[model samples]
Target: MDAVSEIPDYVKRISFIDSNYNWDNERYGDKLQKWLEASSDNRLFVACYDDANALLDGKPFVSKTGGTWHRTYLMQRYLKKKMKRLSWNKTENDSIIYFTADNRRIQFYSRKNPEQKIYHTILVERNGYIQSVFSGTKYEGMGYQFMGRKVYDMYRQNSGSW
Candidate 1:
């Protein structure tokens, strides 16, 4: 396995919020920093645990992977369950979150099985504090996917990603 895959499940989740965000932020932030800076060799580990707990408790998901949101086991489970009822051709029957390198696409993968060979796409747009989401299928003629193109035309007459 790769080095990243070797990290414990819990340690895979980490959040590095700036210390100047809110009340008691300093104390909490300092504690987090201490764990993160515990040792360079295991830095990712400490942060992952800290971030995982924070996320499980309802805080925003954070990651050193440059992702805007983190995905926990619970969230993954929930997504998987939701996907079953959504009627999308999914090959992987597990719940997964996909965050790209450029941070342009943040996707939640709902699989019908672990292989995730095929699935639906749910697109979401986020501003500073609000998020707008849309869902669609992979095949337009199949009626299982979203008719994203039709929705786009209502607003703009130009071509869309759908």
Candidate 2:
């Protein structure tokens, strides 16, 4: 099983939008910085899960060992570190935002899930105001229960008519 073929369909669909742009660019950097500064106190939901367990945290979360929980924890840490650095890029319409980082060899159980993959982080600003970050792995699906009704409603509404 080649790695590329093993990637889930959903992951492949989103691969095009993965952060290829240089977030270090001055203009994008400024916009990202401003957004981060304004959103410093806003609520953030970190939802992670796998075949057997799920965890949600207001702050970043990560597991110390390699297991179903490792991906979620790694994602949390990745997002937090990126937020601290303000390392993100905006889409052409400025409606969607993204951040990505190379996993390197820091993954849990490096023997199996080697660190060659890239983690994709996604964020959206609701009603031109509040911003929320979402990260998840390809297998177990992204958990959304942690987001309050208002936020969930906003997400559903903006997401589509469904």
Candidate 3:
């Protein structure tokens, strides 16, 4: 499943850090550097796109905030590993869908237990990477808990963007 090409044309483009464009090179570089260095846990995982026109396009990146560094780092690492393990395949067993909020359409994919219909992992896709990730065990039911709401709120407060 080629996620990039599969993105619908209607989604807006947002820029992110990559080999050609580093996060430090953007207008918010100084603040981003300070944020990234302050605490490892205070971060928001975001998806990016190379061609979309929204504020989160380009390479997937993490935004810093006033949260627990270790947990965020662990979640980021875990999501990355899980995404890699899934091979980006979206089939009936692995559901991929989109929803509109704040005037933007967001893409999400979920890995669920087939027989029980319980989700193990849910990830937001941006620039072909996992932007936001949520996971739960079958014992916990299907409700998904977002990891970095505070970080994301801080981003909205500072950047006037989402």
lDDT of 3 by residue, 1-162 (tens): 123423333432322212112322223333333343343332332321221111233431333322122222233344334334222222333422222121121122222222332111212212122233221112211232332222233223545445
Q: Candidates' TM-scores?
A: 0.20, 0.21, 0.22
For model 1 the local lDDT of residue 143 reads 23
Which regions in candidate 1 have their CA more than 4 angstroms from the true location?
1-62, 65-69, 72-74, 78-90, 93-122, 125-150, 157-162
lDDT tens digits, residue span 1-162, model 2: 123423332321121111222223232333332333443332222222221222334322333443323443444344445556534322222211223322210111111112322122221212111212222233211433221222445335444545
Q: Rank the candidates by TM-score, best first.
A: 3, 2, 1
Candidate 1 lDDT by residue in tens digits, 34-150:
333343322210001223223323443444322312322233233334334322232232342332111111123321223312111222111100121211112213322321333
Sort every candidate by lDDT, greatest first: 2, 3, 1
Alpha carbon lDDT of residue 72, candidate 3?
A: 29
On lDDT, the stronger of 2 and 3 is 2
Which candidate number maximizes TM-score? Answer: 3
Shift of residue 89 alpha carbon in model 1, Å = 10
- Compare the candidates by lDDT and give the number of the best one: 2
Score candidate 3 by TM-score against the native. Answer: 0.22
Provide the lDDT at 84 for model 1.
42
